[model samples]
Target chain A: MANGSGEVVRNRQVIFRDYVSGSPEETDMEVRESALELRVPEGSNGVLVRNLYLSCDPYMRIRMRKLDVPSYRESFQPGSPIIGYGVARVLESGHPNFKKGDLIWGITGWEEYSLITEPETCFKIEHIDVPLSYYTGLLGMPGMTAYVGFFKVCSPKKGETVFISAASGAVGQLVGQFAKLVGCYVVGSAGSKEKVDLLKNKFGFDDAFNYKEELDLDATLKRYFPEGIDIYFENVGGKMLDAVLLNMKLRGRIAACGMISQYNLEQPEGICNLMNLILKQVRMEGFVVSDYYHLYLKFLETVLPQIKEGKIVYVEDIAKGLENGPAALVGLFSGHNVGKQVIMVSRE
Target chain B: MANGSGEVVRNRQVIFRDYVSGSPEETDMEVRESALELRVPEGSNGVLVRNLYLSCDPYMRIRMRKLDVPSYRESFQPGSPIIGYGVARVLESGHPNFKKGDLIWGITGWEEYSLITEPETCFKIEHIDVPLSYYTGLLGMPGMTAYVGFFKVCSPKKGETVFISAASGAVGQLVGQFAKLVGCYVVGSAGSKEKVDLLKNKFGFDDAFNYKEELDLDATLKRYFPEGIDIYFENVGGKMLDAVLLNMKLRGRIAACGMISQYNLEQPEGICNLMNLILKQVRMEGFVVSDYYHLYLKFLETVLPQIKEGKIVYVEDIAKGLENGPAALVGLFSGHNVGKQVIMVSRE
Candidate 1:
């Protein structure tokens, strides 16, 4: 698989077709072959890397729309290769921090290779004791998202009741385990029974419920959290949010990590019970993980040990090739993926 | 005019007729005469007071319904005398904190005379330098609500942009003044052109708008706050809240004081733009002023001087007697009152 230095190579890329309005489909993106030089362009401080594992995240769905307002990320260009977080092996570098053959993880392309102009945003993969694929889910952005959301944002105290929506997803799974580590009671809601089982049996949630089967979400929440929720890690929004508002305890905190449920709709479902926020004296805060990247090293220190000791676990649903990337990403909207959805682009 | 140490008197009362749905009407309550004893019951720690000024607040509308969940205030009991905040003169007291001839402000009946069993909750009026009617608006519950909500909940900084809804109402008026005092640029929205004029010209708000005239609230907010709102004192909810969510600046804070717009509706309006809270990394919190009563003395220390120096002013829409109490309270739902609506039950 080794190519001569500076040799021209064929790169397979997933290209976004156009701006999306409703639920994104596999046809919205296409896998195509493009030519690339296996070198950083002369006089440019860019790092050329061959992407390995690409992360299929819900937030990417937001970037598919033509955002009329300010957002943390720009909308994906219609004809360009889709940009996302991925594990990559640096092929050539003109940057000070990165070198050829160095393994890294950060914002890369959904293609086999990418020319990253801002390589400084990339983290050098220092601890490969865990599988490199973990960098795309457990040990990378999602893990850091869980750490910041649960510990910094929600500030859960011992014995507090915690609830996570999309519980078997990458970030929610980690949040549940972190709550357990803090000695808080944790319950989770997912779209399927298998995911529910994984939350309770594998991730150590105190209880789990299949939200798709529940006719009344407020009643379902009451059944799971009889004492009321002290912390809610919001991933799926809309009706789930409205229902959770009714069941929040006094001074409860909701960390708005993502709203996967509403991203694909032309009109996001209306949340009707925000009055409960005032009645219960609650705080709901929204945050971006990039704001807390300065604490990434600190996060790894706290989480890495737990993973090694088997105190924390991550479940990933891996698609075996770059060709399957679009389906894996689109599956998120339909709750078709059982866990953390990842595209395995290459072995090295 | 003085009765002997103890005597029976005719007490005119505003009685809640039944649980109300939709817009509360004057017919929901009735003016009636009932007998009252001027003395506290034997060995009872109660204070019998002559109600003078009864505060008519928007939150009272919520109490007209049958509340099935927990709330800061109890539902108005059907067939019972309506309860509310008022300025009163103590006629008798078995409680050590109060005595006969003392002036107090707290929860009292919508009647000429009330026997307050929970006299401890009442604040004894210390300085009569200002008008006694001020206690019902500027120096009592609504005043404390504005203080805690602005200084404590919003944590507004100098030069920040503040926007308040229901701006000429009891609490919003004070919040706007407090924000201006903090060196912040403040804009307010009210229902009537007269109220809007009071906000800008009378209350010294930087700008004000008549919300009723603005068909597109979001566009109106954008016009008023071109730089985006940093702190929003949320007094009216529903469409206004949804619009504010879209116009909030980065890391903005929204203090949910009350939602007068949704109180009388059978189904509260759905908020569709809460996703902006995430996109902007915003914090929206709901609070009840009762939680901050420990800081009342501190609040008075800060506000009383402003009143004395003519740095702050108050406006009241005083209804003549207990007979007008129902209409005064009902007026809040229709935006009929100009400022703080207070019913003068008795001059003495």
Candidate 2:
């Protein structure tokens, strides 16, 4: 590739077909190739980046739906490249925040090269000793989300009880680890036996259960937390939340992250045990990590050292090429990936 | 009646028949005569008090239901006196906190005399200037509940928008006034037109509506709070809470005081828009005033002046005697009483 107006590359992208219902299938997306220039637009505060790693998250499923009111995220445009968090290298820059050859991570197009007009949204990657893909999981949006949601929103204290749903996924795994670090009694629920074993043996969750296998969520929660739950990191909504309400201790906290189970449903399941909120004096709050993005530098300072010292661990399930992007993105809902789902697009 | 060891008074009492499934009817209770000794029980720390006023509250309805697990308030036992907040005068004392002729307000039996074992629960009434009946409504449990739930739990700020449900009742009316005093734009909803009028015209609420007349609660809330609600003092739950959830602004606070609407339902209404909490970064918390009982002294100091200076006002709907107690207690469920429903058991 040459660094001039004449130089162009075939930028392939996974395009969202249309709005979907139930679970998204791989065929709902189509791979298409478009032309891309190697340089950022002239006289604009934009950075042209070569995309490396793409993050697969449950929240993207919400972005695929049409909303009646203004939401925190916009619906994905039909026949356009799906947008998500990615690690990239700056090929050209018209922005003061970044220089050519600098590595950065932020929201980007699911293509080989992207002209990021919102240059300020991306953060410059300082530490390189760890895998660059770490930005997609441990140091990126999902990691920051788990950190802020647990510590800031939930206000967890040492020796408190913590519960996580979708426990082996990107955010849940880190939350479990973070709760363990804070000396809390952590329990998590996942869909498969492998994920459950991973939570207990690998992630150090005090107890783990397969939600699919459990016939009674309330009884299962009672079995795991005999005293009652103090902090519930809500990832799966519907019946799981209903059970959690009954099992929450007095003055418990619920950090609503994502409701993977109900996002695709035409109408969300009704939460029946809400009156328990009044009985137990519980607080159910929801938060988006973008609100606490200012804490990213501080988060990196704490997490990078832990990662370097082997005090913290992050696992990634990587897909090796751009064509497999659709399957990876759609697979989040089905729990196909073991850990943080990342698609490796290019090499450094 | 003589002042001797065997001397007794005819104690006319209202006794709960059994656990009720629906709204408690007048027939659900039976009035019968029991013997009350003029003196406190010997060899026990009990104070004999002559009952004066009994409070009829929404929480009492919960006590009439059989539960799967033990709740804060136990189910009313068959053939036992209905337990509630009451104003009484100490006839005899085996406890140091009270002596003979001391007027107090606390949990007492619905009969002529009560042997109060836990004297610490009673607060000695110092001033007789205010109506003694106020201890059952404005000066007692409901008043403290409103103060703590609004100021402490809601953490309201001036210029914020506030919405209260069941707005003409004991706690709601006071909360509306408190919001007004704090420079908040307050709107309230009640079941009857008279109650709505009482809220806006008498209680100083900025706006009021009859929820019974409003077909679409969500649309009504939007009309009342065009900019969205910043603080919601939840009293009547079910549909009202569900509507309030949709109208809550970013960083909104919901203080769950009581849920009069859902108390009689076999299965409580499901709250579907809880996901809004995460999208708007809202905090919905449930609390019981007993947790903040330590603030009682401070509450009286703050409220007494307001009442004396005519900065705040309270209304009471009193039934003349213990014979009318069953009707007053049952009337609470039917929205029959105009204000705080109190049974005037005896004159001060």
TM-score of the second chain for every model = 0.98, 0.97
Question: Which pairs, if any, clash in model 1?
Answer: none
Q: What is the per-residue lDDT of model 2 for residues B1-348, given as tens digits with 9 covering 90 to 100?
A: 113474678888888899899778889898899877677666767788889999999999888888666556678888999989999998888887788899999999888778888889889998789989888888899999999999998998999999999888999999999999999999999889899889988999999999889999999999999889999999988888899989999889999888888888888888888888877788889898888878888988999999999988998999988889889988887789898999999885
Candidate 1: residue B346 lDDT (0-100):
80
Cα deviation at B302, candidate 1, in Å, is: 0.8
Report, for every candidate in turn, its global Cα lDDT versus the true structure.
Answer: 0.92, 0.89
Docking band of candidate 2:
medium
Model 1: per-residue lDDT, tens digit, B267-304? 89999999998999999999998899899899889999
TM-score of chain A of 2: 0.98
lDDT of 2 by residue, A82-178 (tens): 9999999998888888999999999999989888889899999999999999999999999999999999999999999999999999999999999
Give every collision pair in model 2.
A286-B278
Error of 1 at B248 (Å): 1.1
Model 1, runs deviating above 4 Å: A1-5, B1-5
